[model samples]
Target: MKIHNPFRTALVATLGVGLGILMITSIQTLSTVILYIGTALFLSLGLDPVVTMLERRGLPRWAAVLITILAVLSIFAAVVLIVLPVLIEQISELVDQITPLVQNGEQTIESLKGWMTETFPNLAVDDVFAYVTDWMAKEDWQNNVAGWTETIGQGVLVIGGAVLAGLFGAFIVLVLTIYLTASTPSLKRSAYQLVPASKRERFIDIADQITDSVGHYVMGQVSLGVINGILSAIFLSIINAPFTAVLAVIAFFFSLIPLVGTLTGSTIIVLACLLPGVGSPATALAAAIYYLIYMQVEAYFLAPRIMSRAVSVPGAVVVIAALSGGALLGLLGALIAIPVAASILIIYRQVLIPRMDQR
Candidate 1:
């Protein structure tokens, strides 16, 4: 006899599918809200120590929150004011230089062909140049330009919408952060009351440890990115590379991605150098090689030393975490991978290891 309840089964299936659809829709519609909430929580944790310090100095919680937010906004505004125009100019120059750079590259190829034909008498320079020029001319640059323009126009609309949504979400998170920070003690007390009396202290300790771990990781990552940006700018300047500032900024932003970011940044820098006519092919090759070596050194020496202090997870664990995180959540997964791994390690150390030892 079939004992299945058809109504119950249908309800369960419908609920599951509905929940999946809701999640997908939320990712698209409320993405800005998610981003804001995450960012605010991260920032709130980092600023907590400062807030506590201010409280000890006799300032109210609201005053501390106001001070922190104003300080952050002021610094952000300063950066935009100082850097935005220069970045815009550099980008415009880079775009304007592209067509001329391509023409020069074609000319360079033709010159090399001529030399090859002269050195080896049987070589056909005419056919080679003809083929090269034809290929270059057939690049459909106009179509590409038109397509890029269309894409940019669409991107602007999407970005504008996102920005508006982000602003709204940010307002909400800011309000929530102020309230949460002010009521943190009461919130903790309430949370602890929910737990069994025996485990209450242990739960609080675990929660605090997790908070500290995440806070340190965020601060460390930001610090590392800044250092990388400054070092990149200095190196690019020494090499007399065009768009040094722009490349530095790009490097800083991309360096947020774990292992692969440096390589990506270096590739862009090398390609930019190649276009500028300042570096010969040999020089470009040397630059790429130099960057690869630098990346290796940074990965092996700099990253471990910097990140070890922030998150105590081992190298092997970090690699596995990064890979798993990337697979799971793409960029966001990778960004928080180390911290997530550290949390797991913390849990294992505090709970599992202790239990195992006792047994």
Candidate 2:
């Protein structure tokens, strides 16, 4: 279509541009609000399955929700009261152990090289070790590392302000989560009312499946984290590994993130087991071997069983979805990616494929 009047066309174009700019500015301003709401909604969905299970056991919806919320609060309180002190103490000890290494880069590098050589005599690491040593010797790399370490150490002091802000934000999220969880059914009804009557039934079916998938996935992931934490705690305690509680806590939280979390946590745990005065090569080797086996079991056994029930996504698709999601929005994106992908797969299988076949 050609514009009949240039002045009117230009005016409309300018208005459109202004509107677009306004939208971008508004979104930027409300980014934190958006994050809080999204996180709360995600958590509410995760809590839904537990609420439903309680309701199935003959409790009213409100009662079920109350019980579930109370249980969650209890868990949170326990972590804060019982675990936080131990975690803090162990972390302080860990920092103390790391202080010497941070101050002396050459010694740290040499120690690391010696450990690697001792741990795996057959591994060809001499050339790589020489290169690293040479690099560290040149360009005052030691000071640079020390500077970075100092910056990180100083960051702990500034975290008080961020912690206060985070607490306020967390309270908001908790309140939102409670409301969302309690009103989920009504919310679904309200949403369904907006759909055309002809399509509403199908929409409800698909929507329910998607929500169920998300809820189940959350539960499964949490279960995996719990398992990892408990097992790590037991194994570490058995082997007399330093900071068993702290390491287990790390394992738990990190395992909450999808695919890469377990491996990342495992690496940290292994490294922690190799701390200069506190840890030995034997302990680090044992931790490494245990994690290697655990990863295999989780991938081939545990994950397949738990995740298969939620979404029958292909392994390749799962990896790609997680990577893409993580790239786009970090942790939250990665957590949401699988269920979102599952929802898409459901639509493809139940809706699009049928329509295509008809065509």
Candidate 3:
């Protein structure tokens, strides 16, 4: 391995560095594509268990894959068809209510003043209200509204572009997921062929365990989200919360993220319960209390049962993994972090620990 010519060695080293930089640049440019592939692979792994269950029930692999895909698509379609209209209507209503307040500063301030006075009868708010009213009166409400209108127009354009891009990305991921799920066994065989024959069995074992763990974790997380969504809808309806359907949808999606999702969703739900016309302090308080209790029940009771089959990552490791992953790759990273951590722990325990012991 000794180099005879120093210049030749230097030239080779420089070329290697340049090639690495080129590769890095290429990867950075293709990061979005990579993200889509990773998401597809993750979802395919999650679908593996369902496909396996169908196979066990005497269905052919193709049939299993077809059924799984159909089931998922049906669920998604049902949600869009049943929930989207109601969600849009509620959002429109909210916008309508907010528009008048923004348009009429005087009315908004007067309403705020009245609320403050009624909520805190002992506090003298006359001077504060007068100052606020005078300051608001000095500003040009028409000009402000014009500015807001312009901003909203620009925002709508941006949102429309983003939505188009998102839809395209989703379609790509969906196709990739279906392909990956269908060809998973063949793909695994091809990959295993690349490994040294002597070590292939061990590799397969570890790979299967990791994939199984990932599938279980995804299923468990989805179960938790569904439970949260259903219960949230019922409870919010009982309390006459504004936009209950929207809030429940929010709860479901947020609950898919680990650790902080429930807390973040709960905070939003409570705030929504305090909105004007449809909410009161009592309603907010009630929502807050319910969430606090629900969090405890989820942590102690539901999560354990649902997630029993998934690898048990340590709490500290889960926290660190989630934060680091989120910092690195945003939401996708956070979603995959715990399972990745579990996989790493598996390797450490099975390989590293044994090697160290041999030493």
Candidate 4:
């Protein structure tokens, strides 16, 4: 007689659901790991050429790695030394000035309102002022300030941890870079062997193109960001803008985000300048106009020249990639969008373009 397997079925069903959940959790964790590893690997790949050149001059792999790591660390240290003190000072100043700034802004608005009332006698200036003062005095305002302070404190701690992790990760990447660079040819051959003999050559070719495109794009963007930062810093210093160092650093990071980034940076700098009484509204307006013109030149001339030499991605594709990446992943996605787009473009050219041509 055949017995019903109700207990076995229930056990199997429960185990299956448990395993599915575990698998999903594992995949999420794995994805995070892969993202971190991929970032390090890409950096390693970009630095590999330098390692190769040194190795060609008879330097041992270990020595090359040490030198590369030292150079990176030294540059990082120098930047921190040059910029950190200024940033800290600016931040402290900003915090101290916040209350006074708010009071000044309130006064400015009130003065404007009074003028308007005198010009147009029917206007309710007193009512407007009362509303503004009430808004400022609200419980919500205090809550917001308290919340902001807590968030800032937490952010500082997180940043400290992230910096430590980044330093450790950099060391790991340096070692891996040296090893990968030294064995790149062998690695290529091994990778090619994994493909069927008929497809090996094509696969290798596509891989090489992708690597070159992505590496060049990354390097070019970094170069452009550095240039923009230096130029911005010079301009800010010449103009005697408050927080010039902080604003320049902000410009540099934002410049990594492509089209809208520079505009955002410029607006921020202009607003900060307005607060410090360094410029009248008209002067701020003039600076903003200058920034717009400069951005146009940079976009049309500087960007195209640099990007064309680095990667052959189309303008339309870059815009779309930036918008989509920004929408999906905020600033991080925007920063990597161009390289990601270039990689996709490489895949399309290598894989799909030929297939379409055949058809």
lDDT of 2 by residue, 202-232 (tens): 9999999999988988889988998999899
The digit string of per-residue lDDT tens for model 3 on 1-359 reads: 88799999999999999999999999999999999999999999999999999999999999999999999999999989999999999999899988998899788878877887887788778987777668867896556988998999999999999999999999999999999999999999999999999999999999889999999999899999999999999999998889989999999988988889899999999998887666888899999999999999999999999999998999899889989989989988999898899899989989899989999
**Model 3 clash tally?**
0
Scored by lDDT, model 3 comes in at 0.92
What would the C-alpha RMSD of candidate 1 be, to one decimal place?
5.3
CA shift of 205, model 1, Å? 1.0
Q: Candidate 2 — which residues are off by over 4 angstroms?
A: 100-138, 141-158
Which prediction has the highest lDDT against the true structure?
A: 3
> Candidate 3: minimum summed lDDT over ten consecutive residues — where?
133-142
Candidate 1 per-residue lDDT over residues 1-359, each given as its tens digit: 68479899889999999999999998989866676666566666766666777889999888887787677679778877877887898888877766665678767666566556755589777887788668867996656988998999999999999999867876787776766666666776898799998998999899788777776677667766777788888887777778777988887877876666677878887887765344445445656777888788788787777666465777688778888877976766777787778888889999999999999
Candidate 4 C-alpha lDDT tens digits along 42-67: 66656655666788999987787668
TM-scores, all models, native as reference: 0.72, 0.87, 0.91, 0.76
Query: How many clashes would you count in candidate 1?
Result: 0
Q: Model-by-model lDDT, in order?
A: 0.76, 0.90, 0.92, 0.75
RMSD of each: 5.3, 3.1, 3.0, 5.1
Instruction: Name model 4 segments beyond 4 Å from true.
Output: 1-21, 49-67, 99-189, 276-279, 327-330
**Residue pairs with backbone atoms closer than 3 Å in model 3 (clashes):** none
- Positional deviation of residue 113's Cα in model 1 after best superposition, in angstroms: 7.7
